[model samples]
Target: MLAAMRTFELSPADRFTFAQRAAVLSAAYADYFVPLWVNAQQMEAMDQIYDVDARRSVVAHAGREPIGMALLSLRGPRGWISAVGVIPAWRRRGAARAMLRRLLENAAQLGLDEVWLEVIEENAPAAALYRELGFSAARELLTWRYPADGDLLPIPRELLQPAPVERALAHFAAWHGQPPSWQREEPTLRHLAARSSAYELWMEDALAGYCVVGERPDAISILDIGLNPDFGPVKAGRTLLQALAHRFRGRAFTMINVPADDDLSRALAALRFTVTIRQWEMRLPIIAR
Candidate 1:
């Protein structure tokens, strides 16, 4: 009797062949509660922004057909895993494990001090896998959504002032406690500077909060929104978001990765924003020295 031979191959993703990547991501995330709303072009653009290197992907194949995929990116000493998925029919056949193990190995070889990724809150299997792979949860983030047409009261424009990039960056940095990974260093500065418009909120003639809007062709993404800790959560958060929505009235808006516990969550809910999804940030340290 001959031993059974496992049939699968793992290879780097080819940049020119994004159709494959899109197919896999779409299938794997089809049931996802809060979809990233990514398309082929968006995936390609993300690869460009992150600068896809050879160590960035592991694609599992049986014969010539792709069955699983994992994508990684280097952010300084941190390794960021963006999309990792195995086709439903291929699940539990070692595809996900193989790809993840390879990604971790690649991260170690690249001298990354830590690896991090986000998981949807309801994804128990994925969360278990991450924990089993030595990754730990760092924080919880919320995705809020609201109908484009909602009864929102108009906010006074005078309460909102344009925020200078420098001022916005400084305010974000000085936020109490640990800031989310996206708000750090280059990424934060880049996001703020790249925004179509940024604003500072004022209440009782004092600065209360700020927000930056990333305007897309069809919708506006609330990239970053924060309130001064001293301003008290209820008043500051409500004022800031109301002012933001007022600024973009008649436009579709969505916010990605807002902290679940933040006061903004409550305000948005009150304004009829639906809690679309919950995401968990995970990290793994790679460099010991």
Candidate 2:
């Protein structure tokens, strides 16, 4: 007979070590071969963005061996499902369902207004599970990427002047044609301030386009870029991509979760950036029970 499954919360005293947590996630995603895997340090950095609470993140065990886990983030009334996974050996068990139900209950208890997450567009089973749990499609997000080919030199830096990081961040929020997806929100960029910077190219001192980039130990990630929507996407897109390529030339970068059909997306494509991945942002309104 299979051992009885039980769950427990993470804690500040470090009841569950970071290595242990990383191991569970790595095993849960062991079959995936692309983009390498997330290490303990990377997980730590990511957890900070969600304001992860140990008491709220759940770990499941079948007789002391971890079989599944659900990591949650609580920011005000917004609860984000940062990640959820079950080890291969434990697949088809009810652990994922049980853990999510527990997580939603926890969120409701805290009086959260809503919960959110992203599911890969091709992951049908996972999407179905989230849908069954009351998640609705919020928006489609796309990841655009390009290798900084040494052969492709950037235009002179004089063409794109470095902008004040703080001021530009503010301008980005003000210029958004639509509300930004959670990962691309200003708060995320600010929280990651230690390793990030922003730049702007002006059409005579007013903002033409601007981009934010962050440098982690292992990844040089593009957070987001904002261009004047009034100028039209193709033109704004061209200017922004060229300016970005010039600024961060020779170093491959991946921009995460930009609106799929917007001007930015078109610009990335026109610049030959490839779609590395796509995800559906899903949301759940937490009605207190």
Candidate 3:
């Protein structure tokens, strides 16, 4: 059986064709909770933003044809299993398990102490797989979206002004109550700054909050937003969103991985940004080689 002869190998981005990896990912995620599609260009961008380590990632093959791929991102002693997918037709044949085992081994080889990944709250099979591999659920993360059709309520122009990216990040630690997810980490935001824009909210001439957004081909993303603890979260959040809406009129917006209990989450709800999905961050300790 072809399934019996399946194999897995490291396919560094430099040595592998991203087009092939992107095709497998698109096919593998066809039935995902949210629609996801990517081309090689986006893959390359992700490679840079996510800090993907080519040598540690894995590709699964069934008799020499690519069936799945997994990417690993390294940050000092930690590893992030950023993406994993096996094409639909080849699922249930141990491809995912084999690929993950290879990735864990790779992590061990690199002296990483832990590896992290996220699974949709409703994805039992994937969650079970992670648990079986010694992962533990960490925390809940929420995805929020606001449609572009609604009236853009006017914000006080003097209170909300365009900001340089560095200015927007000036109060990052004071603004967010919890550490951001891997994608929104300071380093990643800096990596994406070239393609993103920012806005700062002022209260009585004092900087109260700020937000960074990057326009995707489909919708604008609220990459990061933070409010000074001295200000009311809802008011600060509302002003930020209104300013953003006015600046990028007619573009829908999405914010991913906000902590479930975050004030930002509440602020988004108050403004009618519906929850699109919920996910659980998971982590596994890796035994060094």
Candidate 4:
């Protein structure tokens, strides 16, 4: 099986065909959660200058037919397993494992300190596979579908004024609280700067909390939110959330990858947020060969 799998490093933006990539993703995730449908706009967005380096995306071909792929996002000492897929016909033939192994070897060669990925909490088989490959459970992340209407009474606009993107980004950089998953991490936020809107919550002259939300088309994705660790996560989360709730009144939203045990979860619970799904962030440390 391994002999039939010819691996090729793909520079997706330059050489690989999008339709082929999309086909593999769809087939691999046939029974998986929300199978990917890579639309034209999404493809254009992917081509934009994000932290992702196309050369790290690997494709496995069985006699010129793409059967598996693994997408990587490089961030200096940190690397992310953004995606991994194996078509239905390739499953159980060791295609997924082979593709992953090749990616890991290449990641190590790139001198990354650690490589990380997230798996659905209920996916026992995938989790076990990752553990066997040296990945360890790091933290539980929650995906919440929050539709609760917050206090309708208006608050001081000054308290939740628009903040400088750099200011919010700096606060994000300085945060020492719960470790964030890929979507909420600094690299993703930095890459999304231009399209995301930023805001900071304040108490008098002190900055208490901040958030970055996706604008327009995807107004529901709360990309990142945080507060001063010393100020208290629960209080700040509520305050910040309240501001957001009022700002986006009657509009529904979904937040992803929030630490399950953190104070923010308590705040979310108080707001009647429902857990849509849960995921586990897995980490693997690397030593160059």
lDDT, each prediction: 0.72, 0.74, 0.83, 0.74
**TM match of model 4 to true structure:** 0.85
Global CA lDDT of candidate 3, please? 0.83
Collision pairs in model 1: 113-286, 113-287, 115-284
Candidate 1 local lDDT, residue 94: 79
- Give one digit per residue, the lDDT tens place, for model 1 in 180-268: 54433346446347544678988777777877777766577776676787887666777777777787776677887766676777777
Clashes of 1: 3
Every model's TM-score = 0.80, 0.86, 0.90, 0.85
Order of candidate numbers by TM-score, starting with the best? 3, 2, 4, 1
RMSD of 2: 3.3
Question: Model 1 off-target regions past 4 Å?
Answer: 1-6, 14-16, 35-40, 50-54, 154-157, 162-167, 175-177, 181-195, 202-207, 216-218, 229-234, 266-272, 287-289
**Per-model tally of clashing residue pairs:** 3, 0, 0, 0
Which regions of candidate 2 deviate over 4 angstroms? 1-14, 33-36, 150-158, 216-219
Model 2 TM-score, 2 decimals: 0.86
Q: What TM-score does candidate 3 reach? A: 0.90
lDDT of 4 at 14: 26
Show model 4 residue runs off by greater than 4 Å: 1-15, 44-50, 148-159, 217-219
Report the number of the highest-lDDT candidate. 3
Over the stretch 184-204, how does candidate 3's per-residue lDDT look in tens digits?
888888898888888887887
Candidate order by lDDT, highest to lowest?
3, 2, 4, 1
lDDT of 4 by residue, 1-289 (tens): 6345545433232245767776666667777875676754564465342355556667777656677777777778888887788776667766667667877887888888999899998888889888888999998999987664534534435457787676798977666377677777786787788888888988767888888888554346788887887778787787788788777777677888888997878888877778988989999999733
